[model samples]
Target: MKRLPGHGLRRGQAVTVTVDGEPTAAYLGESVAVALMAHGDLSTRATKGGENRGLFCGMGVCFDCVAVVDGVPGTRACVTWVRDGMVIERQDGPGARRAAPGG
Candidate 1:
């Protein structure tokens, strides 16, 4: 769902966040899922079978929107707010691991 301008909804200042090694625009106070979805990134994670998954429930009850954030795995994007320079990546599987430094 694209946010149309002139809606009169107050939004925080725009900032950039990195997703899958690419920079995307996001706003303060919005959830990480929102930031990713707004930038046309519908898939937040992938299952072991390589099936893409996206936001199912806006709330954190559902685990469909789990992603790796800031080198941590299994983070729920729906409840995590977007921060400037935040790094986010889709989880490839249940055993996704953070890359080693300088590798």
Candidate 2:
């Protein structure tokens, strides 16, 4: 989806977050999904059938926006607020796993 200029309400302090190793601009109070979608990133994970999925409910009810954030797996981007220096990665599937800490 193409986002228009001056979309949504005014945002808070601007910050940088990494999505799949690429830095993107984000706001402090907005959800990670919102920030990513603003950058034209609609897919956050792939289904078991290899189908891409993204935000659905925009609320925490739906798990479609799940992604690996800050080294943690199964994080819902819709409810998780963006933080500076956050590292988010797209999930391969619903059961995607992250590498062992310090491994």
Candidate 3:
């Protein structure tokens, strides 16, 4: 497969992002981290203890690869390719963050 070229996405590159119900388009060849960051969604997942986490390690070494993409859990945005009409959501935390309160 061929790469889309880094960050070169224009209005017609064929990518979309929906964060917390809001939608936005993304350029091809751009990392999911870069796309979300562009829309101010730096914290792709919430930590178990209520801490915000995103792309700390650009490499695929971090469990921080927990991004909800198109209804799937634990998708690595930093390495995943941007597709058309993709929906992204921040993981609550390591333990789902909801039971902890104030998350």
Candidate 4:
């Protein structure tokens, strides 16, 4: 998932976010979905039957791109902005429970 030519030249400050415990490069103000896609990781979560789901209806009309962010589950990756040191993990299914604070 290569970025459009010249599109990378006008991005916000560079930042690093941890995705699935792996350090992934991202930019401030960029949505987590964009960052994930740019890193060649399209699937954000899976269905109960194990079907992978990713970016869809980029305007947030859909909830197919949900993932756990910074210990919070079911976050819409398409709208959540990336921040330095942000922790992101690909969710497994729709039954994910909210992570306990500081846990």
How does residue 64 of candidate 1 score in lDDT?
90
List TM-scores for all candidates, in order.
0.83, 0.80, 0.73, 0.82
Write the number of the candidate with greater TM-score, choosing between 2 and 3.
2
lDDT of 4 by residue, 4-101 (tens): 87675667999999887779999887999988787776988878887889999987879999999988888999999999999888887874632333
Distance from true location, Cα of 52 in model 4, Å: 0.4
Model 2 agreement with the true structure over 1-103: per-residue lDDT tens digits: 3578878866699999987767998989999898768777698877878788899999989899998899887899899999999988878776574233364
For model 2, where is the 10-residue window of minimal lDDT? 94-103
* lDDT values for all models: 0.84, 0.82, 0.71, 0.83
Clashing pairs in 3: 9-27
Error of 1 at 21 (Å): 0.5
Per-model clash counts, in order, read 0, 0, 1, 0
User: Candidate 1 has what TM-score?
Assistant: 0.83
Runs in model 1 lying further than 4 Å from the true structure: 1-7, 95-103
Where model 2 places Cα greater than 4 Å from the true spot, the runs are 1-8, 95-103
Error of 4 at 12 (Å): 0.5
- Cα displacement (angstroms), candidate 1, residue 54, comes to 1.0
Q: Positional deviation of 60 in candidate 3, in angstroms?
A: 1.3
How much lDDT does candidate 2 score?
0.82
